[model samples]
Target chain A: MTAVSATPTATPQPRNAVIRSARDSLVVAKRNLIRMMRIPEVVIFGLVQPIMFVVLFSYVFGGSMKVGGTTDPGVYREFLMAGIFAQTVTFATAGAGAGIADDMHKGLVDRFRSLPMARGAVLTGRTLADLVQTTLTVIVLAIVALIVGWRVHEGIPKALGGFALLLLLGYAFSWIGALIGLTVRTPEAATSGGLIWLFPLTFISNAFVDSSQMTPWLRHLADWNPFSATVQACRQLFGNPGVSQSPAWPMQHPVWASLIWSIVIIVVFRTLAVRKYRHATS
Target chain B: MTGAIYAEGLVKTFGDVRALDGVDLDVPEGTVLGLLGPNGAGKTTAVRVLTTLLRPDSGKAVVAGVDVLRHPNEVRRLIGLSGQFAAVDEYLTGRENLQMVGQLYQMSGRDAKVRAGELLDQFNLADAADRPAKTYSGGMRRRLDLAAALVVRPPVMFMDEPTTGLDPRNRLGLWDVIQDLVAGGTTLLLTTQYLEEADRLAHDICVIDHGKVIARGTSDQLKARTGGERVEVVVHERERLTEATEVLRGFGKGETKVEDHMRQITVPVTGGAKLLAEVIRELDSRGIEIDDIGLRRPTLDDVFISLTGHVAELKEDAV
Candidate 1:
């Protein structure tokens, strides 16, 4: 048999590394976005939970719960929207983790690892795709919030800023989810592992109830939670009531605290998640 | 010159389990090297290391003239890998999957689309190209996976048990595709437990067991190493087993083996069919009626059993 010599074109020309990484990441992201579009039920289910929280909290305990000092239902509805929006974005961490874990289980990650693409592209692309889904979910939830007597007292620009911060926080938390996904054995484990900490993280923060009502130490812990910082930031940006009067630094400067916390989480967790991804065996 | 794909003294351990214990391999350009082994024999581990999916504990590997450990990304550009699992995205259409793979390989969008169409047609997946891969059968999915691996037509390819779970017809179909790839000058490293697959496709076979290479040669060489042709006879009467053995031993080159319950006698021999006819005549003249008699060459199964003291498949945890 005649030997086929390696052709000159067979060897890829050297390109800018950063540009290739970004391009590869976008390609992966496009694939995932297509998958999400095909599986509409996942997006629908993602939307249903946040919508339910909005409706249930607005009608059930709006008047009974006290925010600031009053028990007014209208006052509480405005206060509850920010918390629900933050919760909606943060809760998407489970889906991100489960999605990655499923990819690993099905060997798609192995397929990607064998390719010449950037090492972090798979994760960055996945998180970016998930961020899009979370954005859609937040949009629908905002409509639900509007129908339930929840209004953004601030101008449209500030409200958009609030939504931006919520997404940033969501994107940051996805790295944590990505790390959990890589660490766990199965998607089911990833789902559970992703949520087990989120419950405390969101609940202990100022997302739902007023932290001032709690005792001193628990209040302190709640005030310092990263989840609370974003929630507090959203409230201030949206010009919603229930702003914290706590002496804690983050409660006073919620927007800066939120930006710092999200950036820091992205740096630390993205580093860990990308490192874990490179050495992942299965 | 060294082979296009070469490795020396590769060692990888997963905790206490030594998945690969100093393995070596070399596959020249445009040739197929079959890494034949039972389950958990480190075939997957070796493929993973060569494909840059896993790092070996200690080893030297070069693919397409690039150092695997030091320049894995460069090696990745020159190789395609289809793993044990069909790693296509189930939610994506067949065309979408191929296009996605092409884009990942850095093909332009229009180029990826054109390549996807061509591959879908070549793999006989054109009809199902627009359908989600989840709707396809196992064989279709496997074909699509193979097509995905060929998105860029790299010079080197690694298929870990490419036909393990495929049905017979699909297995033949895949064998045809693989042969076409090799004929077009793609260097291939295929791993499988089926000796017949290795015999039909591999130019050279490496028999690995317990994370070590026990034998390496062409199909005929391994079979010849096991043993030559044997004359097996099953006598009609249980009482005549002794007579049959005595008759067979007269022409036998080795000790005659007798299975009393089956009334069968087997003896190794060097002569071809001529000796078999003479043995038959001798048995007939002695009034030793034979129920069955045939001269059979040792199959690769026999080679495996002889070399590893077990069959070519074992139920164990995968490496």
Candidate 2:
């Protein structure tokens, strides 16, 4: 084997540590994608679920609910389309978190700690891999949404912009999921916690129904939800006609609210996740 | 770069249990250090500290010239670790696993692939390179894991019970692989329950029990420390087992016992090979014809049982 270093001894690697760290993390993410690709069934499941959700909610549920006194109306699809997009992306975040828990259980992440890689790479790589996955899922779900009469009212650039927003929104959720995976000892708990957050946050928000038409308390909660901020952002970006005109702080521009919420959630949850990781390993 | 690795007064408390009790280690370059310990013996805790996986709250450690506590990332770059478990992802093909590791060390795509293929062939996983690692047998998984650790060729390597589940044939095969690595100028710190492994692989062995190194010396030195010649007498009849045991009892004053499972009588004799011949002659005179009579030095097992009151515990706590 040819040694890369020409010197008699290898020395300390002090300069460009972060660049090397990020490069290493990119390798980790690519490996994850390869692993995910190996289980074609899992990839198929991840792809199919969002489309099924779009059909179930937009067609089946859309016919039953009346908005503006018109049952069997098409406006509900437009109203809930962006919200559904957000929900689909949210569902994909569990992959990042569950992957971490599996790696931990298998002792892979612990092995990385003994190597010259960045401490955050394990979590960061999972998040980055999920960003790509969530993007792919978004593109596929978008096609399915189009099949179900869900059209983007915005121009091509704005629609592209909307796609990027949904992905960032997914990445934020992925960070939370990564923490969940790192903190939770078992895969079962990691999965259940993801579900516990998903069902309520997705359902209780305006993703399924109009928040204004719900009970005063439920409406207030949904109005303030992070998912709602995301959905509101999606509505503006997609140029959807039924976009709510809520002027809640950081909500007027759904884009900024979603971005801020994603950043805040990433910071708070990652700090907790890193702490849990340090605790469990030591 | 002075001592290859230094761990001083390493202390770790897991809630109420003190896993490591102020353990201290100093290892020089270009040598293999065998850490022999029973289950929960804190050998792993020390490895975790020196490898920068876990922080030692009260102690300072340096690995390959870098302080592990203050500069973990630098220490990380200089060390390679193959853990107790084969931690490679099952879904990845063996080749992909190696490639991923190479890339993790910042090797370019072409360089990483070349290194990955070389390791695949070196570890004899080339034929199975494209197959997912889940399909590899236990021995193959272990070999691939070791190969992955060598992707960047770090100066220091830590193997924690690397051959616990491997069969005898595969275990020997892995021993050869480790020997080659160490012979090629890699400094290794390996922990194992197999006394034969330490005897074969480690130049100097550290016998640790209850979170402390009770003894550290060369294989011969350790065996001589627990000085005694061991006799294994294989006889024809099962009842003769007891007869050989009784006769051998007369030869050694320390301890004499029947190894019913292997059909041999074992006794600790201060007398060397000359006494072995005398014992055989006495058994023959007493009409106890033997199939085989073998005399050997005490193993690390004996030194451990003498010092710690326990056998090696590599299997019990394996991940």
lDDT of 1 by residue, A157-268 (tens): 9999999999999999998899999999489999999999888888887888888998999899988888899899889888888898999999999889899999999999
List, residue by residue over A207-229, the lDDT tens digit for candidate 2.
Answer: 77766678878877887888988
**DockQ score of the complex predicted as candidate 1:** 0.53
Q: Model 2: how far is B230 from its true place, Å?
A: 4.6
Candidate 1 clashes: the total is: 0
Off by over 4 Å in 2: A1-18, A245-247, A271-282, B230-271, B283-296, B314-319
Candidate 2 residue-wise lDDT, B1-319, digit = tens: 3567778888887777677877887777778999888778888888888887787668888877778889887677777889888988899999888877776665677887998999898999999999999999999999999998888778788898899878999999999999999888888899987888999999899887767778889999988888767888888888778767878888876777777877878777767778888987898899998888888778788888888776665445421
* DockQ score of each predicted structure, in the order shown: 0.53, 0.44
Each model's lDDT comes to 0.89, 0.79
RMSD for each of the candidates: 1.9, 3.7
